[model samples]
Target: MSKVRAFTILEMLINLTIMSIIMGLIYFAYASFVKQVINYQVSIDEQNELTTSYVQLRTDFFNAERIVKSYKGFKVIPYNNKEIEYKITDKYLIRRQVHMLDTLSINKLTISSDFNIITKEDLITKMIVETTLFDEPIEFVIAKDYAPNLKLKL
Candidate 1:
């Protein structure tokens, strides 16, 4: 008779245990990678939102005929007779128009002017918008020069 050798039950069980541990480790690594990817994606989305809001505000400022201080925030009146209002809060900046509303998330915001019209206390000539986006601070300055023929709010 020829001699034969085979794996013992104990050895088989140990092998299965080792394989199970390896699979668990692989699963753990994959799960952690997926979680990190989700976090990165969320950060990118936040950055995009901040950029879009900044662009919209800049466009409105550039096209504005006049910008006036309001109780909540400020008003942008364009040459085309459209009224846009921006409401600022501790954590958000809300933009409202005829039929649309846009809420922008921000860390901090400060709106001011370098100087105003001497005759009109509320007439904002140059708007200085200081805000923090995604932990970085930035500023935007929008100014509108008026012609003698243009009408004043006063």
Candidate 2:
């Protein structure tokens, strides 16, 4: 009677090496996929942050009666008893709401919105903001319309 052949040691060793190579390739592919997912998440977060900043800025400006151009920056006294100020300093844009007690960093506002007359109350304000997120540059321009009764009658 003929005996069934068993796998030789050399054949088993070759099978193990092939399996190891396949496993290594699979691991490399998985690592690449994980890295791409992480990068995508980071970009989404940056986009959300930029959107929130612009929304807050629009809300503040829309609710403001008038805006004053000052040496520090643009100042506004809202009818809701809150004083808001916007400033550009050291490559950062800052917004401070005195009554709300909130401070936030917004992107940079370009010089186009700046007024030549420092002492005038500007009813119509234009804002040109340039900012960077995750090494990407973005810019936006906003034109704010103020209420006609902004100047209180003394």
Candidate 3:
């Protein structure tokens, strides 16, 4: 009688072991890819938020009737009487105005200014916002040239 060919028990176990190892490797690779994608998405969202916040801040600065430096950030007094205060920290910047608030998350934040007056007391002609995103440095400078007579109010 001819013996029917079939996989031996040892061969079957070996096949299963190889398959398990391959599957484990594939799972690990997939997990890593997913983690990287998630991180990339988070960074993109943060970048968008930072960009939008900067645009709004620049608009406020341009239209501000008066700007005063506060404890950490600055305050913008618009002509319509809606006073906006920006509070900055290492991690976030918060813009508060009347009934609304906007928060921007940042890795690092630094604010500086160019003074037009020699006294350097609230005579900020240009305001600079410096930050870093994904190891790339970014800066936003907003300048408002005030009339000589209006220097004190600004």
Could you say which candidate leads in TM-score? 1
TM for candidate 1 is 0.78
Model 2: how far residue 143 lies from native, Å: 1.7
> lDDT of all predictions, in order shown?
0.76, 0.69, 0.77
Query: What's the lDDT for candidate 1?
Result: 0.76
Residue-by-residue lDDT tens digits, candidate 1, 28-122:
99999999999899879887887888789888877887777777788888889789999988777899998999987655565554234454535
Select the stronger candidate by lDDT from 1 and 3: 3
Candidate 1: which stretches are off by over 4 Å?
A: 1-5, 114-121, 125-154
Cα RMSD for candidates in order: 3.4, 4.2, 3.9
Instruction: Evaluate model 2: give its TM-score.
Output: 0.74
Model 3 has an lDDT value of: 0.77
State how far residue 41 of model 1 sits from its true place (Å).
Answer: 0.5
Q: Report lDDT (Cα) of residue 142, candidate 1.
A: 59
lDDT of each residue in 62-133, candidate 2, tens digit only? 777666666767776677766788776766667776555333344556543433243344443687878886
Report the lDDT tens digits of candidate 3 across residue range 17-133: 999999999999999999999999999987898888889988888888767676788888877878899888877788998889898766565455444365455644566666777
